[model samples]
Target: MAFAVSGYEGGKTVDFRRLAHTGIRLVGITRSYRDGVLSFEEGLAKNVADGDQAYFDVLREADAYIEENGLPFPPEPGAWELLPDPDCLTNPILSLDLAAAGITTIIWATGFKFDFGWLKVNAFDEKGDPFHKRGISAESGIYFLGLPNLVNRASSFIYGVWHDAKYIADHIVLQEGYMSYAKP
Candidate 1:
């Protein structure tokens, strides 16, 4: 199948044909319609473990939705290919060596629990989350970024991170009285 990623204005307008809702919560994993108003399978309210069955269930639902809505399929046709081993999804062995691959940075985005112990800062709450006001902590020279609702609802989104970063940067520059140097 052909695939393309495009951007659109975000609001009430949702292109359900191109999207599916899937999430992993503390309760369990959930895969459903984006609006959650529709269910392809009966009794989909309960969470299930992430596995091949759940993955296929979602694909089947999406296929049904597309067919039911008379949405056009990709022009190209190809047989669906399954991964050789499902275990690779969880424990993927890297084929590329970072040093040989000339990789400088790796963003460890494990989407799991947060561990702030290495921060060595006392600016955290009892729950261990950083205690900050729009990324600015009580302790000077320390800041946070890309956290949910850090400044607004979009704080964690890619489209919103720059605003948060700029806010923090401006705060740092102003607080350090660097504006005097820029006056020329």
Candidate 2:
């Protein structure tokens, strides 16, 4: 059967037509006229047809990594358990226990968060807020990097990480004046 599908912008339409001529049937246009909606089925179909096994392989590898690292859900749960410094403290219970055990200098590298629900301050909006325009949180002596919209709207890209890193370094330096570094 012959079909004339439309609405796809750019080279995708041409690519689809070329692929269709090669025995691939143009069943239907997948995308919607509305914005922000993605067509997963169509994307999957295209990936399968194109023999793009790399995508699925990466997903499988990520799943395996999560499983092996005891991060069955969020994909990297216990991956951070073995910190490079191993001096940083995370869990409050563990921190208290360690404190009781006479350990000091609990370095917390729990990473960044998009949600600010823990903060009782007005730093958050009606919804939990981003740390900065990027995705930093409001914990004292804490720094964040690699967040979306750190500098510009599109600062989430790899190029923008430098900007975020610089900001974090500056903040760390400034925090040194008010923050004391001693063993707990």
Candidate 3:
């Protein structure tokens, strides 16, 4: 029940086993095919076990990380328990209908908030949050950095911060046509 990566609480490890005992399941969404459109549907079961190429690739990388970091995970069974038949694994999506399950309330505890009250522009969505493509606002020179999913899921991470900074720098240079801007 251990997660491969957990970065909650400013670097504190949570007891997921205890959480699981309380019927708290840690789950992730299966990658959806957008066909060039950015969209995802609730409970979309598009990927499963061995048929999911992305899953296999990520599993391989996680295994490598676990080994390199000398994690306590057992090597024999490894990080994931793969069954002989893919069908044996329960469907990634357990239930999609929350109302049917007697669900009357949902509390979104997403531990992130945005305060863009200072930015006066039309680069915002109905939710009052700045909507941009890879941090580039619709308005010129108004770029957002270190936002969640701004460039990808890791955009707020330290590694992502540096990567995004470089991307924004390059984008500014290209947009402004700064021929003297040197790249190291």
TM-score of each model, paired residue for residue: 0.42, 0.30, 0.45
Model 2 alpha-carbon miss at residue 67, Å: 54
The digit string of per-residue lDDT tens for model 2 on 29-133 reads 333323333221223333323433443344577788878888748644442221121111111111123344464563545234465466565445456654444
Where's the lowest-lDDT run of ten residues in candidate 2?
A: 85-94
- Give, for candidate 1, the lowest lDDT window spanning 10 residues: 21-30
Candidate 3 stretches with Cα past 4 Å from truth are: 1-15, 18-57, 60-76, 81-110, 178-184
Error of 2 at 174 (Å): 1.8
Which is better, 1 or 3, measured by TM-score? Answer: 3
Query: Model 3: per-residue lDDT, tens digit, 10-85?
Result: 6433433334446654333423423332223333223332234444565688789998998988654533443332
9 in model 1: Cα distance from truth in Å? Answer: 12
The model with the greatest TM-score is 3
Q: Model 1 off-target regions past 4 Å?
A: 1-110, 178-184
- Candidate ranking (TM-score, best to worst): 3, 1, 2
Clashes of each: 0, 3, 0
The best-first sequence of candidates by lDDT reads: 3, 1, 2
lDDT by residue for model 1 (81-136), tens: 33232232333232334455465675545245568899887789998999999999
TM-score-better candidate, 1 vs 2: 1
